[model samples]
Target chain A: MLKSNPGLALCILIAIGAICFALFSGDPYYVQVVIWVFANAALAVTLRFVLLIGELNIATAAFFGIGAYTTAVASTILGWPFFISLLAAPVIAGVISSLFGWITLRTKGPYFLLISFAFTEIVRLIYTKTEALGGNSGMIGMFPPMELDAYFPAIAISILAAILFGLYAAERSNLGRVFKAIKNNEDIPRSVGLNVIGLKILCLVIASTAVGLVGGVHAYTNSVIAPADFTYFVAVLALAYVKIGGEGHIVGPIIGATILTLAGQFLHSFGPYENIFYGAIIIGALLLVPGGIVGLGVRFKAGTLMGRAGR
Target chain B: MELQVQLLMNTLQIGSVYVLFALGLTLIFGVMKIVNFAHGTFFTAAALVVTSVMMWSVDTIGMPIWFSYLIAFVMALLVVCVIGFVVYFFGFKYVLKDLNGSFILSIGLLLLLNGTYLILYGGVPRSIPAVIPGNITILGASLTIQRLVLMIVAAIITLGLYILVHRTKLGLSLRAVAEDQEAAMLQGIPYRRVALYGFLIGATLAACAGALMATVTPVTTVIGDDFLVKAFIIIIIGGLGSVLGAILGGLLIALIESFGGYYFDPSTATLAMFVLVVILLIVRPQGILGHAEK
Candidate 1:
C-alpha cells in the first residue's frame, strides 16, 4: 500500500478535513488546536526533508525558535505588523539553517547529530540569555492577527495545509528521489556526480522556512511567545510524531502530530507520566513497530508479519 | 599570578568533570556503536542518589564522608546500570543494527529518564552534603579541598580508564567489538558480555560525574540537559568513538568555558565552545582524534 505513493490523495483529504472542521467547529479553542496541529505537521514534514536525506538534523526546534522569536521581536520591538513578521520568520530561519548546514552537514553519524544538537542549545541559550528575546523568562505581548475575522482560522489552516501539501508533493517528485538516494547510499549519490552538499543545503533552507512559518502562526495564535514552547521537548515531540506515524510518508507526520497533540493535551493530568508514555510509545514503535501504524497496516495486508516487525 | 593559577585550576576541574561525563558517552559509542542520549539521565539519577543519601542518611551502613561518596557512587551505578541494561536489552538490542532506529530509541529513553527524574526528584534543585572540610591556599591561590580532590579523582579515573582500555583483556575485546562486531564474534569474543561491561562502565562514569557535579552545581532535573550538551560538544570536538578524544575534548571545552566565562559573558563563553566545535567539525569532520573507519 505504501509503495503506491498515496501522498497526493492524502494531502487532499487533509485539506478538505481541515476546511470542514474550521467551518463547523463552534469552539475557538478546538479550531486553534487544529491550527496548532497544522503548524506542527508542517514543521514535522519539513523536518523529514533532512531525515529523508539521512541527516539527523535535530535543530528543527532551533529554527522554529528563531521564527517564533523573530516574529515576537519584529512585532513588539520593531512594531511591525503580524503579516510582515510572518513573512520574515521563514527568511530568518532559512538563513540560520543555511549557516548551520554549512558548518554541520560535513560530518556523518553521531558527529552530525552532535553538531545539530549543539546548534539547538546555542539557539536556546541565546533565546534565554538575550534581554532582547526576553531572556530566560521568554517574550510575551506578540502581536495577534490584525483582523480577528471569522475566516482567520479557516484561512490560516488552509494556507498551512497548502504549504504542507506542496512540501509533500516536492518530496514525491524527482528531486525527492535524489534525496532518498543520498540517504540510502551517500557514496552512490556522490559517485553519480550529484552536488550532494548543495542539495542538502537547499532542502535545509526550504524545510527551515516551512517550520518558521509554523512558528509564526504559533506566535499569532497565542499572541505571546516564549522559549519554553519552542524547546527541545517540542523538537522531540515533532520527531517522535514523525517516527511513530511513519517518517517515509507525508501522512505519517500528520497522523502522528494529531494523535500526540490531542493525547498530550487531554491526558496531561497524568503529569510527567505523559512523557514516560510518549517515550515508551516511541521506543516500542521503533523496536516492535518500525514501520509505524501505517506500516503495520501495509504489512498485515500483505501477510508479512515478520517484515512488518522490522524496519 | 595567583588569580591566574586559580583560574587554571578551575578550568582543569571543570574540564575534568566534563571528561568524566563524556567518558561514558564515548565508551558506549565506541563499544556498541550506540549513541545513548539516556547517558545524561544516568548522571541526573546519580545526582539524585547523592541528594537522597544526604537527606535520608541511610544509617545502617554508617560510613565516613569519603566512604559515603563511594557508597553513593556505587548505589547510583547499580541503579543506572540496571536501567541501562533493561533499555539496551528491550529497546536497543534489536534496534542496534539500524542506526536510525537506535537513535530514536535512545531519545525515547532520554525522555523517559527525564520524566522519571522530574517525577521522582521533583523539578526543584536539591543540595548534596558538602563533606569536605575546608579550602587550601597554595601560593596565595585559594581552592576548596573538595574541588581539588574531585580534580584528582577525575585524573585518576581518566588514567584508570586509559589503563583499562589499553592494558586489559576486556579493553582488547572492547576495541575488537568497536572495530567490527561481526569479526569479533567470529573470533569467538563474547560480544554481548563486552557490551554489558561497556554499559556498566558507562553508567558508572556518568554517575560518578553526576555525584561530583552535584557538589558544585547541586542536583536538578535540568542538569541532564546542560551536561548532555557539554558531553555532545566534547564527544564531537574530541572525536566520536575515541576515548582519548573525549578526554582532550572535555579539557579543551572546560578551559574554553573557564576562560571564556571570565573574559567574556557566561552565555558568550558557552556559545564560543559550540561555535568553536562547529568550526572544528566542519574543518575535520572526523574530530581531533577520530579516524574514519569503514
Candidate 2:
C-alpha cells in the first residue's frame, strides 16, 4: 500500500523519524514540541474528519478534554494501571460523542454548529464547577510509569501518529465515501436505505475517539490538565489549521498544525500580539487563499499544466 | 411576594440587554445566513467608547453626569456603527451566506478586535459613576433608578425594531430576503444592500446593549464575551433568525439565570441552561418559536 501511494509512504517515514528523534533527542523541549505537533495534528484531522459529513463539530474540543479528564481520573483517582488509564480515554470519549451525535445530528448547518459550540463551553464549565476534576486550576501529577518515563515521548508521538494514520485509512475506505455522499445530500443516501444519522454518529465517534486518545497522551505529556485548555477556541484554532493547510486533503491540517505550532512557540513572547497574528493569518487565508496552501499548490500545478497544453 | 417581584425585576433587567444582543445575532443569521461570532466585539467597542466618552465629558469637560451619559450613548452608537460598516465591507460582505467561512472570519475579527481592545484599554475593568442616582420601590421591590431606565430604553429600542421589521418597507425587504434570497431578488429587493442594513441594525442593537450595560456593570475588554455564550443559548432556544424567538429566548434564559442562580448557584444555573438546551433539542430542535430547519 505504501509502495502504491508515495504520499502514504512519506508520511510513515516521517512518523518513524519523529519517533526515532523522540527516542534519541537530547533536548526534552524539542521532544515536547514534537508531541504537541502530533497532538494538534490529531485534533485538526479529527475536526476535518467530521467535516466529511459537512458539519463543523466544535465539540472536538469537548471530547478531547473528556479524554484527558478521563485518563486523569483513572490514573490519579482510581489508580488504574497505565495502559488501562490511557485506553479509557477513547472508550469514554466514544461513548459520550455517540450520545452527543445521536442527539445533535438531527439538526444540521447553523443549528448543529451553534449547539456543538454550546456543548464545548458547557463541558468546560462542568469541569471548572466540579471539584474532583480540579476546577479552574485543573489537575496535575499525570505521570507515565517510572520505567516508561524515558520512552513516554516516543510512546505519545507513536500513538498520536497512529491516530493520524488510522484516520487517513478510514477516510480512504468505503465508509469515507458514504460520509461524502451524506454531505453531498443526505436525502439521496437515505433513499438508498442508509442510516444517515447513525453514520454521522459513527463519524463523530471515530473522530472523537481519536482526539480522546490524543487527550490521554496530552495528559501524560503536559502532566497537567485544566478546563481552560479545552475551550471552543481549541476547535477554532484547529479549524484555522485546517483552513490554512487546505482542508482538501488530510495532509493539509497536519502541515498547518506543524507550521502554526512552531510559529506559536516564537509567538509566545509577543503577548496580545500573538492572537492578533493568528487572527490576521486566518482572515488572510480566508480572503486570499480560500483553499489554503495545498489548494494553492493544486491551482499552481493546474495552471502550469494548462500553460503546457496551450504551448 | 417581594422576593418574587425582585427576581422578576432581575429577569427583566438582564433579559433586556440579552434581547438586544440576541436580536443582532439572530437578525444577522436571518439576513446573511452567517453567524457573527464577532458580534460581541461590536458590544465591547461600544462599551469601551462609552467609558472613554463618559470619562472625558464628566471628568475632563466638567459636564453633568446625566448629560455626559447621553453624549456617551450617542457616541458609542456612532463608533460601533462605523466599526460595523468597516467590517461589513472589508470582511462580512464576501462571506455572506457562507456559514463556516463567516464563522472563521468573525472569529478572526473577534481575536483581532479583542486584542486591539486589550492593548488600548489594558486589562483593568472600568466603571463610570451612575448618571442617575437613587432607588425606587416597585411592588415592594426596591430598584435602582438607572437600571429601571436601562430596561425602559431597551424596551423602546426593541419595540422600535419590532415596528420597523413588521411595519416598514425595509422590514418587508428584510423578511422577504431572509425567507428566500432568490425570490426576494426576483421581486427587486437589493439583497446585498438589505444584508448590509440588517447587519448594521444588528450591530447598533448590540451597541445599545453595551452602552446601557456600561452604566450598570464594570466595562472591560472582555465584558461582551461574557454575554456571548448566554446569547448563543438564547438564540438557540429562541430559534435562529426569528426576532420573536430571540426576544422570548433572551427573557427565558434570563429568567432561568436569575431564578436558578438565586435558588441554586451560578454554575448550577449555567448547567441547568445546558440541560434545558439538550431537552429542547430533543423535544423541539427548531427551538421554542424557530422555524423548522430545511
TM-score of chain A of each: 0.92, 0.97
lDDT of 1 by residue, B139-205 (tens): 7889999898889988899899999999999999999998889999999999888988887898789
**Predicted complexes: DockQ each:** 0.78, 0.85
Query: Candidate 1, after superposition: displacement of residue B71 in Å?
Result: 2.7
Docking class of 2: high
TM-score of 1: 0.94
Residue range B1-294, candidate 2, lDDT tens digits: 999999999999999999999999999999999999999999999999999999988889899999999999999999999999999999999999999999999999999999999999999999999989999999999999999999999999999999999999999999999999999999999999999999999999999999999999999999999899999999999999999999999999999999999999998999999999999999999999988778
Off by over 4 Å in 2: A304-311
- lDDT (Cα atoms) of all candidates against the true structure: 0.81, 0.95
| Per-residue alpha-carbon lDDT of candidate 1 for residues A203-247, written as tens digits (9 for 90 to 100) | 888888888887877776677776777666677778888888887
Off by over 4 Å in 1: A1-7, A306-311, B58-64
Q: What's the C-alpha lDDT at position A64 in model 2?
A: 95
Worst 10 residues of 1 chain A by lDDT: A1-10
The fnat of each candidate, in order, is 0.91, 0.76
